[model samples]
Target: MKINIPNPMFKIRAAAAILKAAVIPSNLRFPGRALVFLDMVRAATSEMAADVGNGTKSDVLMTPVTWLQDAIIEAPIVALDPEGDPIEGSELIALLETPNPFYSLEVLLAGTTLSLAIDGNAYWIVNHGRGGEKLPAEILYAPHMNMEPEWPANDPKKFITHYEYATKGQPQLIRPFGIDADDENAGVPGNVEKGLSVIHFRKGIDPDNIRKGLSPLKGLLREIWTDDAAASFTAALLKNSGVPGVVISPTDSEVNMTPEEGDAAKAKIETQFGGTNRGKPIVMLGPTKVEQFGFSPAQMDLSALRNVSEERVTAALHIHAAVVGFGAGLQSSKVGATMESMVRQSWYSGVIPLQKIIAGEVTRTLAPALGAASAEFDNKGVQALRENEDLKAARIGRLYRDGVLTRADARSALNFETVDADNVYLSNLATTFIPQGQAAPPPSNGNGADPKGILARLQDPAESLTNLLKAHGFASPAAMLAQLGLVDPGEV
Candidate 1:
């Protein structure tokens, strides 16, 4: 019998094919089937983010999602070098500033965040570098509807290793992949038979459900829709319902008409006074008494009801209504400041976590390729951290002068990377003085000028006069006068 040998390449391709066949038609399971339940959010017939892209279904109709998108994209991100310092003027920053031909860094991040917020997953397909290395040259975001994750039920702790990109008319390809545990680089998009170089950022993780991420506003979307319906109903009621007024009622002395005559008279009456003319003056015949019913729109508090709905939608999106110049707080400057503070808090609490996630993914995946130690997306300007830079510097300076902190410590505290501290100096007099048993302190020049002639230029007469006493070895003009026991002619 001829010996049959197994080819390694054939085995790998065969395994990949088998995996792809198993995963392609398989239906993934979610924890709450929340997306399905959220179908009624946009309307009774409208699709949810699960079917379309996140926030896309309601984007044209809802102000909250659009306003949130604006806020999310308003901030720029900083790229960090391996030494935990910002990499200014780097190619990576350029790439991030313009992730692709169609979108800027802010736009890309905003889209990613919207995806995370709506669908609970963001797919980022990274194009390879010119050298065929797995570095990302361009990143394209894929909607959750376009991506199909193959999560094996047997393994709960494991991440998805196989996915199918189901684009219209594109050939279906199966891929094998795994996240780099040590480096935590999960974004690698390619044929699994070769390797995965694409990143899938999944939020709201749990052991029970690996494929689906928990969306925080899933239920709130439905509630918002409900509130919208209520507001609409209230509006329609006010618009269509005539103000409380009455049609004239006939007294018992009047004779009843035949059914046909009564229907004719009813139609005639409604034609004259049913809708628009309900509140208008009526020219009544003798003893045609009038009575009214129902309350006015103001009495029903329609405006307050609408305002409550707006407030709820704003809160769910983690944004202030006043930020968009809409709410009651928009008119006053004090309220405007409150809105600004709210924005800062929202950025720190919501956007910062999302930023950290993106930064972590970028650092782990791109650092090695970029030859940097690590990378990060900075949010200093977005969070208004730069405004306090002067205050932080002052605090760090005080601590350093007190000898309780070092130059490196001060730098670290002020968010700067460490550097050589050998040449660093403290200007505190306490630190400058010699110890009690050591040599005496150096004599002062009786002026604030540098002893090493650093400021010896004396740019003007004012500068020269300021240094005159120091150059003459007098502590002050007053001290010299006291020694002489008399004032100078100028002083007199």
Candidate 2:
């Protein structure tokens, strides 16, 4: 029998060939279709009074997305050095504060978070100076819908060769960071000059295409459609003054009308008694009967169905319905501490994880471009991320009082600077003055000059301890007894 092992390089080349030949899925090819579908669903649902919409804000998706964006931007981006310490007066911080003349850090974060929520991907183009500087001059947001990645045909080690940015004008080609633009086989389509590198932040992974991300909304399409239909039904009912669909016909069998006359009568009835004319009276030449044909809103249990749909939508997006103010969550929620807990839950489950992804991408791409070691969001300033001050203070105080923590440690836990005087543990007053391995002094016999007079003064612990030490030829304060070898430090 012969034993044989396959070559690792051969396997790598085979895998690369398979990947290069793999066809991109429709979801990755046209991400804008999903967004358009979401917009349509929102429009259909906006007719209901409970669906929040005003002017440009009509999408129910905006509720959670806006909440997440606001929470993420609350923590400012901080630049870090090689030793993992936050750097002060950094150029990266200045660039982030004013990413470009047109937008601030808040706007940049808002746009990025919005794109990630809708399309599961967000991109930023870092534009360098004309003088070939390493630091970026300006950073511009590129909408995920308009961007497409191009892969190399022959290179097994490379993933994305370049990115194609399609706009109203000519399509621009952008080079990836660390890739030379002058490379002959850059895999760009045209002879156009390529733009700067793009930093991408994505949420969930897409199994169909490794280069693209799958939107969370992809799995909730049915839920959104059901909710939209429910809203449309409610709106239709309200349009008719909460009346169900009805059928109108003559009761008398002998009084038959022509087809044209029936059509005319139907048109007249709708024109006079439908929509804005809902409250108008109906009159007929002959005896007529009207019968409702469909189920009423209460009979269909539409409210419960809509509530379920709302919950599924918020849950799939990693947000609590209570945090989004949906009626479904509000019905079961309380006002004070419960609401605060829900907000904190939303920050932990939704906002913080997304912020980590954005921060990691920035550390990998934007920080290096700006000559920094790494980047992170400074969440210490965020109110939701911070522990309750009252609770934290009580915990530190208890630890200090119990001698589990030194005074300096307690102060440091509360974010205060360390003081040298606070470095020692506090002595327990109950056990500090108790004598150990020593006999009590003899009582005085009414003599003014007796050495035992120090024993009579033992009523006051501090005074007696000091006098006793002085009577033994050591003149020191009771507080300083710990410094001397006469008494154990534990007792003092």
Candidate 3:
């Protein structure tokens, strides 16, 4: 006997096999294009505004808050349709389609879900009622003028005529919706109409449909149903869905689950409910306790977990206590003091009050200049003048006496007087070609510097010879070193 078996996807009458489940279309719908397009507008405007604010350009004042809110309001209408046309009735259509941070957005006509016009924010909130639904209708004006302080406060004068023409007054539409429709939000100004941004839902939609469509993805996305029958079943659920697209909000996602946490959660599903979905909720991809330790996610029925043991559901409570504890302690540490608090510390008493640390630095740096001033000018007051030119000359002369501030020194100090005389000079060879200079002036023994005694211990071999040579007035370090008889060939 020859027996024939029907293939899984063969729906007898329709004779159609949906072999593969279609992709869950992205929220933006068209692959990466929607997001890319969205970003271009956001970034282009954001960048231009940021550039203006950052001083890369001028005459523009852009606060990021204003920019972000505007972007949210403007992004959808400006997005282009695939054929290079601006989307039809763009404003209203795009609003419904465009997502917000928290939920789906749409310019709902008060109570009903029927889409309104995008042609112009040309909205007429007409009172509407059909079947059992009724909504109050009103005329809602869109952003009207393209110029002046109409949109930008500063540029008010830029389009005096345009703003004057458009903004005669904000008026409330005598009727909000068609006779049976409900006016969702109260209206403008003191009337039943107002110009306000609102976020909410349409009334009278099937609760079950909302649950199936607007509801979060009930199970983890798992199991590519390869068998044609199973694939077709999955496809049918999506194909028949009331909502044209899937729109998920961050809130809808399960508190993120670890694989182990998920596995333990899922293993108990069968015992709590029948092996197949008929016993409880039948969500696509099946209820999942997806193993989050980097394995493929499993579709899980969390309702099943309502009866499952807590042992399968574990999450960290104390594992990070140490890190948070350390951060809290650090936040209170002394280094956390504000700059003003640190700067004012010298006015108070404490262990090297932070201000002392700073003042000590100032004094330490200014010591040479101050001390030299005291020595040459003979007093601390600014009015004091150098009593003796030789003393003044000595200070300037001592600048070189220590060593003529070398080029790198002058450039670094910006002037010889303020330069720390102890800086290592190209002339660091000291007595090698010159007389035993007053033991190269001692260094301030402060901070963590290596003790300055190293200079005291070193005596140049050429110091005595140079002194004898200098007695003959060889004049300069270079001239003395270059003299034929002065430097021995061996030394060279």
Residue 363 lDDT in candidate 2: 64
Please, what is the TM-score per model?
A: 0.56, 0.67, 0.14
lDDT winner between 1 and 3, please give it: 1
What is the clash count for each candidate, in the order shown? 12, 0, 49
Q: Please give the distance, in angstroms, between residue 43's alpha carbon in candidate 2 and its true position after superposition.
A: 23
Candidate 1 local lDDT, residue 339 = 64
Q: What CA RMSD would you report for each candidate?
A: 13.7, 12.0, 31.6
What does candidate 3's lDDT look like per residue over 69-124, in tens digits? 22222222222222323333443233333322333332322111111100011122
lDDT of model 1, residue 7: 35
Model 2, residue pairs in steric clash: none
- Give the best candidate by TM-score: 2
In candidate 2, what are the lDDT values of residues 132-190, reduced to their tens digit? 33567788888887887666545444456678889889988777654556555444344
Candidate 1: list runs displaced more than 4 Å: 1-67, 86-91, 127-137, 145-148, 152-158, 164-198, 218-222, 242-282, 285-295, 302-337, 366-373, 383-492
Two-way TM-score contest, 1 vs 3, winner: 1
Residue 340, model 1: lDDT of 62
Error of 1 at 248 (Å): 5.3
Best prediction by lDDT: 2
